[model samples]
Each structure stands twice: as C-alpha cells, then as structure tokens.
Target: MRYRRFGKTEMLLSVFSLGAMRYLESAANAEKTIWHALEVGINHIETAQGYGKSEEFIGQAMRNGLSKQRDRFYLTTKIGPTKDADSMRRQIEQSLKKMNVDYVDNFDIHGINLYEHLDLVKDPNGCMKAVREAIDQKMLGHVGFSTHGSLEVILDTIRTGLFESVNLHYYYFNQRNAPAVQLAHEKDMGVFIISPSDKGGMLYNPSEELSGVCYPYTALYMCDRFLLSDPRVHTLSLGAANPSEVDSHQDAWDNDAPMSELEAAVLDCMNRRYTLLENDRCSQCYQCLPCPEGINIPEVLRLRNLAIGFDMVEFGKYRYKMFENAGHWFPGNKAIRCTDCGDCLPRCPENLEIPRLLRDTHDRLHGEEGRRLWE
Candidate 1:
C-alpha cells in the first residue's frame, strides 16, 4: 500500500486503512482479517466505542498473537462527545483497557454530528479537557474528530483549529463535502474519508445502470480511484468484513499517474444521468433549504437521482428509511413533510415544482424505517 503524510500529525499512513466497525464476526476471523490487512501493508487500524464488539475483536487479536506486531501499525479509537470531563476520561480509560494498549496513536471525538454535540465537546469542563488530560498523561497522541454533520457545522469545526485531523465523508457519489476537505487540507489536518464503498452509494451492490455508467471499472474500484486521485484526501477507511475483502482493494495501489480517463468517465456518468429522469434538475443548489418541516430537500432529491437515473432503488429506500432515526447525522424529515409550502419554490434556481418533486421523491424511495449503523 502507498503511504502519505497524514497532514500535521506527520504519520505516514497507508492510503487504505482498516475500519474495525464491521469486524464483528468472530475473534478468530478478526485476527485472520487483521493479519491479512497487515500482510497487505495496511498499517492504520481504527475502531470506535460504539461499534459493537469492535474493540474486543481487536483486543482479542492482540492477545491471541498479534501483540508482538503492535508497533507495526498505528491504532485509533473514538468516543462520542460527553457532557463532562470525568465521564469522558473514564470512557478513554475504558477504551485503552478494552484494546489492551497503553497508548493509542489517535483518539477522536466521535460523531460530532450536531451543533449540540459540538457544544458538548467544546465545553470548558467537557470532553475536550478530558482529551487534553489524556494527551498529557501519554494515553493519547494526536487529537481529532469524526463527523457526520452539515457542511456549515463541519467548516465551523475545522475553523476551531483544535483538531489535528478530521474523519468525514467525501466520495464519488457525494461531493458536497469538497469545500470542507479543501479547508481541512489548507489547515494541514489529516483528512480521512469514511465508508466510501457502503455510504458512498452502496457501490458494493451497484445498480445495473450505475455499473454500466462506470464502464471498464467496477463501481468499488472506480470510487476508490476517484477519491485517491485527490491529494487532499489522506486515507480511506475500508470497512472490510473479511480477509478476502482486503485483497480486493490492492489494485488501487498501482498507477499513480493522472486520472484523465477516470475524470472523463465521471463526467460522462453525470451528464448522462440527467437524461434518465423528468425532474432531474435539482442541481443540489441548497438555496431551498431551512425547510419549514426540516426536510432535507437536496438529499431527498439526490436519492431520487440515484433511484431513477442509476436504478439504485434499494439503496435509496435504505437511506430514505434512516431519515427519522439518523438524527443530526442525517437531519431532516421525509419529503412527505412538505405541506405544499411555497416558501422554497422561489428560491430554487431550477424553478422546479418544489412540493411536487419532494412528494415524488418520497413516493420513489420511501420504505420501512431503518436504523443507523452504530445504533
């Protein structure tokens, strides 16, 4: 695996890092998978307090035999924002004990996905103070944050200049975070892309139309190549569930040349998708926001884009179902919340019928309520 300097942290990290959230099968399997990732040169291992059994799996792997090779990889774990320093410090200690490690290479304030979450972390006697104390005690190294927040919130978090790195979403399917990525790079912060294959439009099970659009490359590889092509993106978390999945991502390691052809492929896919649907003109301008019912208009329309233009009906319904449960991570209600309010009608540069399209989006992608991955 190729390595890059992880911004201000200065750690040379593998372009592909193993995310341990999906490592819930078995301790033996986790060991095998982690061993395979190390064999393939992946040196960054990330887990979280909320990912069920994830920390235990890594700890088991270490105690079972991998302890001797601990220094070969950098370890990272995260905790959700806490209201007080004492509770946050306790959680940090618990994470260390669970991982069978004295110190972690990085500790991120997890899921700062809301304004209130940020407030909790930045509170004088809250998680930030606890993290600083951990750093001073030699229990944590670089301090960072992982977020699923809005663009405004993300930019604000970066501007705080408190974090050494940031783990956020930026993939082929959703480039809304591009500005935030650029800002992070300018601030010399490590930029980690989260769940590129799964959250990045469920590329693991690409729709037939989507697959055809990315002709000459599998959706997974295409998406991987697209993200790594950008210098600002430091690493991508491969949420591999097994040993074989690690091998599948190795091909992206080759060819460090310009991606002119890949760029053309993306442009072609974007242009052709507009022809596939009637109201394909949302443009995601974001001017028609602050909806009276708090519906995420652009996201709902983007789901509509994927469902109709790319035949990603299942993926659409899956994400659409998370509207209510995802909270600030993916805020807003279903498009059905539109009350035919003309408030957003004039703001749309596309001049599209706002209420009608929202209802249509709801009709196309609505399904049973779904839970967030960590929930």
Candidate 2:
C-alpha cells in the first residue's frame, strides 16, 4: 500500500483507507476485517457517528487488540447536524466515549449541503464555534467538513480558511468534485474522498459497455485505478466487508504499474460519454431544496443522467433500487410534493424547471404507480 501526505499535514496516509460504514453486522467480523487491513499496511481508518455502530465496533476492536498499534494509525470521525451548541458538544463527548479514545486525529462537520448552513456554522453561536472550542481544548487534532454541494459552495467553503480538511464525493464518474479537491490541495487542507467506488454504483461491477473497454481487469480494478490515477486524492475510503475485500484492494495498490494505452483510452472515452448527459443540466446545486412536496430533484436528475449516459439497463435498475431502498425514490418535499407553487424556480441555482423534472422522474421510475401515489 502506498502512502501520500494528507494535504500539508506531516502525516502520510495510505492512498486507500479503510471506511467503517458497513462494519456493524458482527463485532468479531468487523474486528477481524480491521486487523487484516492493519496487517496489510492500511494505517488510515475513517468512520462517522452517523454510521450505525461503526464507532462502537472500532472502539471494541481497538480495545481487543489494536490499542497497542494506535500510534501507528490515523483515526478520523465526524459530527453531524446538531440542534445547538450544547447538543453538538454532547455528541462529540459521546463519540469519544464510543470510540474509547481521548482524541480523534481528524474530526469533521458532517454533510453540509446548503450555503445557508455554512453561514449558520460560522456564526459565533453556531456549531462551528463549538468545534473551534473543542479544537482549542485539544479534543481534535484537525477540523473540516463533508459536503455534497456544488463546485461553487465547495470553493466558497475552502476560501473560508477555517478548515484543516474537507471530505467530498469524488470518483472517475463524478468529476464535478474534482475542482474542490484541487482547491483543497492549493489551500493545504486534507482531501478525503467518501465512497468513491459505490457513489455511481461503479464498484458493484462496471456496465458491459464499460467492462468491454476495461478488458483484462475486473470492473472493480478499473474503478480503483481511475481514482488512484489522480495523485491529489489523499485517500480513497472504502467500505470493506471482509478481509478478502481489503486483500483485493491491497493487490490493486501493490500493482501500481503504469496504465496501459488501452486503459487510458478507455477512461477518456468514458469521461466523454459522461459529459454528454446534459439534458437540463441540473448541476446538483440543491438550491431549490426543502421542496414543499418532497422530491429530491438532484438525485432523480442524476439517475436520469445515468440512465441515458450509460445505456445500461442494470445500471438503471441499481439506481432504482438505491432510490427505493434509501427512502429517496420520491422524497416528501420539493418537486414530488410541489403544488406547482412556482416558488422554487427563482431560488434555483441552475434555474431548472423543478416541477417538470420531478414529474419526469415519477413517470420514468413508477409510471402509473407514481401518478397514482402522487396525484
């Protein structure tokens, strides 16, 4: 496994770090998986309080055997939308108690999507002040935030010069976040990539069209290679289920042979294919959110783009499943629930016709069922 400097920090972290999102089914199994990763030289581990039982499982595993090796690894966690300063402080204390650690190497603001939330955080009475107090008290080594906003919000956040790191979605398919990663590098802040492989369902298995281009390597390897190709990406956090998954990633990391010309050409072609999906160009800015009805405009649009861009039936199916299983297929507010108020248009970042897109998503995904459910 190769290690890269985490921004300008003195710490050098593995390019592929262990993500503890799915480590809750069995404590023993999670422990074994984490140990195996450490044995194979994966020294950076990331988890979140929002991920069920992830922090507790890591705490249990470390107490069981990893405590001695603690100094050798970099551990990170995050704080989410707290109701107030008191609540935020309590959450951090709980996180510390659950992790069985006095301090986390990196602690981040979890899931900041709106520009308004950014302003709220920076307010003296807001959560950012609480985080700063904690850092001053030595409760966290570094501070940052994780966002799923547009390039504009990302750039604005980085320019605040308040964070030591930032976590954002990034992958071969989602180049939208690339500029943010570059900006993080320029500002000397750690860049943490969250779920790069699973974001666009890329890691599950590449579509046949993509597989054909990748050839010799499995779709999984191609996805990993694509992300690792960018040297600026400090670490690609993976949600590993077992030792085998960690081992597979280890193999990929060890075999960093230069990309073959065919591989480069294939990736180039894929990028071009992705760029062509500009039907309405939503940009996922989420400026028109909290829709009165409950439509997740950006997600539906993304699925629509994926459906048309890849021309892969299975990919579309997977996206449908994601929506259904995650309770986001038809959100309760925004477009799906819009009364055609026309209130969201003037506030939109991309000025997309919100109601129309929601109607299209409903028809495309559920057709008659969606109409009956919403109408």
User: Against the hidden true structure, what lDDT does model 1 obtain?
Assistant: 0.87
What is candidate 2's TM-score against the reference?
0.80
Evaluated at residue 278, the lDDT of candidate 2 is 62
Residue-level lDDT of model 2, residues 1-375, one tens digit each, is 888788866679888889888666788888998988888888888988888788998889878878888898988898775657888888998998998888888888876766776786767787877787888988888888888765677789889887878888876655667778888988888887887666645555666766665567666777777777667777878778777778666546764446668778776766666566565656766677656655556666666665556654455444544442333212333234557888779988767777787666555654222221111
TM-score top scorer: 1
All candidates: CA RMSD in angstroms?
A: 1.5, 5.3
lDDT of 1 by residue, 113-229 (tens): 988887887788878999999999999999999999988889999999889999999887788999999999999999999989888888888888888877777777778888887
lDDT of 2: 0.72
lDDT of model 2 at residue 92? 90
> Ten-residue segment with the worst summed lDDT in candidate 2?
366-375
Cα deviation at 86, candidate 1, in Å, is 0.8
Q: List the residue pairs that clash in candidate 2.
A: 291-333, 291-334, 293-332, 293-333, 293-337, 294-331, 294-332, 294-333, 294-334, 295-333
